[model samples]
Target: MNPGLYVFDFRFTEYFQMTIKPLLEEGKDGELIDWLKDISLLRRGQKCTNPDCQGTKPMEWKRARIVDKFHWSCPLCKKKVSIRTDSPLAEFHCSFKIILETIVAWCDGISLEEYTKENKNVKGVIAKRIYSTCTAATDWYMQTHPELTLLGGENSVVLVDTYPDGCMTTTPHNNNYTKRVLCVADTSHMPARIWAQLIDNKILDYQKLAAVVVGHIRPGSTVVASPSLYPLLHGVKGMAEVISVEALMALDPVDYQRSLKNLETIWRTTVSVCQDIQNTSNAEGEQMLRELEWRQVFPTPLSQILHDLAAHATAISS
Candidate 1:
């Protein structure tokens, strides 16, 4: 009878039945529903937090009035709640299905306009909400999961590299914005433990770059970066190793190219293996292989050995 809580549970149930269950078919429906029931609604029968008033012995579900698309009000407490109350989707005007779709699109790196069009919704609202949600989720994920934070404290080994990606066209100057991605990875080679920033310029300004890097990377952590970034390392005491590109390029050109090619091949193969592992529910094995593949791309001497090991392990595991 409590519309606020009822609507909340109903929405959750609808989402699971319509979206999640089909995707995770291996999971039991009853179990999932039970799990949902625990966090699904904010009911009035739930003991009122007010200590002084003990009017009702057994609290009842008091129907709440629905205001807008999501806003609602409880009759007893006059408390306001959204349809998404107590859930991450709370405060969102979009349906659960649209939110799920937007999340998927974001993970796949799809544009907001594309996602909005696909869901047949107002582009401005969808875009704004999706971007805000993504940024918040990213922040929350980094905070809750330390392993996902790429640049750990000073003791951490952070690797910084920049690669030229495609250009962006919508700049105020109508100039092509070169995409330089700055990534910080641990020595263990776990999936990028943090969000990578796409830098705007092609030139690597040491001071500016160092500020950004130092802000994220913990002090005293060994920062492995190219010589171009050495300027930024000034004044920053502690373990910061700048590897010279010339030194790496000094190797036989053919051999270097061969190594790069081999690395790319291994990386692609590893991604395929990961997909297969996920399909078979072998997440542990997939994680291991992903780590191995990452080590191969990282600038390290053991890269070749690790790549070989990953190939053998894949074969054996298969």
Candidate 2:
């Protein structure tokens, strides 16, 4: 029987922890498949995609002589398709449970090698494919969301800082390394919106740097940045005010102390995220930053996160 698609429910966080986790721990593959189907992660009464089929009918889920264990059959044309035909698991040939656990591992920031070591059922090659697919879906999710581009609003506190990322630095002797990254943290709400751009060691264009910073921030907003950035951002259009960290510290010691703490946290977090990738190109570094930005902006529950990713993949595949 087909179950209704799950809505964005935070309660599922508890449900997953209480029920699904135990089921997985017990190695109940059949129960896990049932739960996956219940959450719409696996196809149940999905429509047949065969263009040559005679009628538009709901595909039936039945046992199949394959590794996936189940296939969707078109009752009209007898066309059998894998249960993962159109979901995020479309290209993954692994079992449903393995793919689901791989997704969970990816979302939890678990390393691919660590995941394969823990789950003996998944091979190195298969885990890599799953991880790659998850990465692509994440990129698509972040790229499609237009609201993630610009951050902060009028009368909001925006913290801007620079961090030197080692991962983005390819070569130091050749002078082709990424020098530092300018990061903006919008503290208007919880789980602040973060945006960053890598600065090349060779190019120290202040005008270009100022322009990039201005593009990410909205007008009538207070910008808290380093003293060096003051001249570059001074008298720029639409900014409510620009204050140097030193001057602000002198003006209001309490607020300035709090801002210092926030700045330190932001830098620490950025460094930690960048260090996760080892010796990457500028393009890959930027992509990682963008993904980081996306995560910071929307820190939803894992269940909803996976569902949204699956929906995006299904749309593209269809």
Query: What overall lDDT goes with each candidate model?
Result: 0.42, 0.67
lDDT of 1 by residue, 1-318 (tens): 111110122223444457454633443533433332344322223343445434544333333444222334444665544434444444456544454445444433345555566666545676567545543433333344444443555446555544332111111221232234454445434433433454546565657777777676666566555455545664576555444333443564753454334323323323332223333333333233333233334322122222232233233335
Model 1: CA > 4 A from native = 1-19, 22-87, 121-124, 143-158, 162-182, 194-224, 230-242, 255-318
Report the alpha-carbon TM-score of model 2 versus the true structure: 0.76
Position 22, candidate 1: lDDT: 65
- Estimated TM-score per prediction? 0.46, 0.76
Task: Report the C-alpha lDDT of model 2 over 64-124, residue by residue, as the tens digit.
Answer: 7777667788898888877766666676777666776676666666667666888888888
- Work out how many backbone clashes candidate 1 has: 6
Segments of candidate 2 deviating more than 4 angstroms:
1-15, 22-40, 44-59, 65-67, 74-79, 165-179, 200-204, 249-261
- Global CA lDDT computed for model 2: 0.67
RMSD of each: 15.5, 7.1
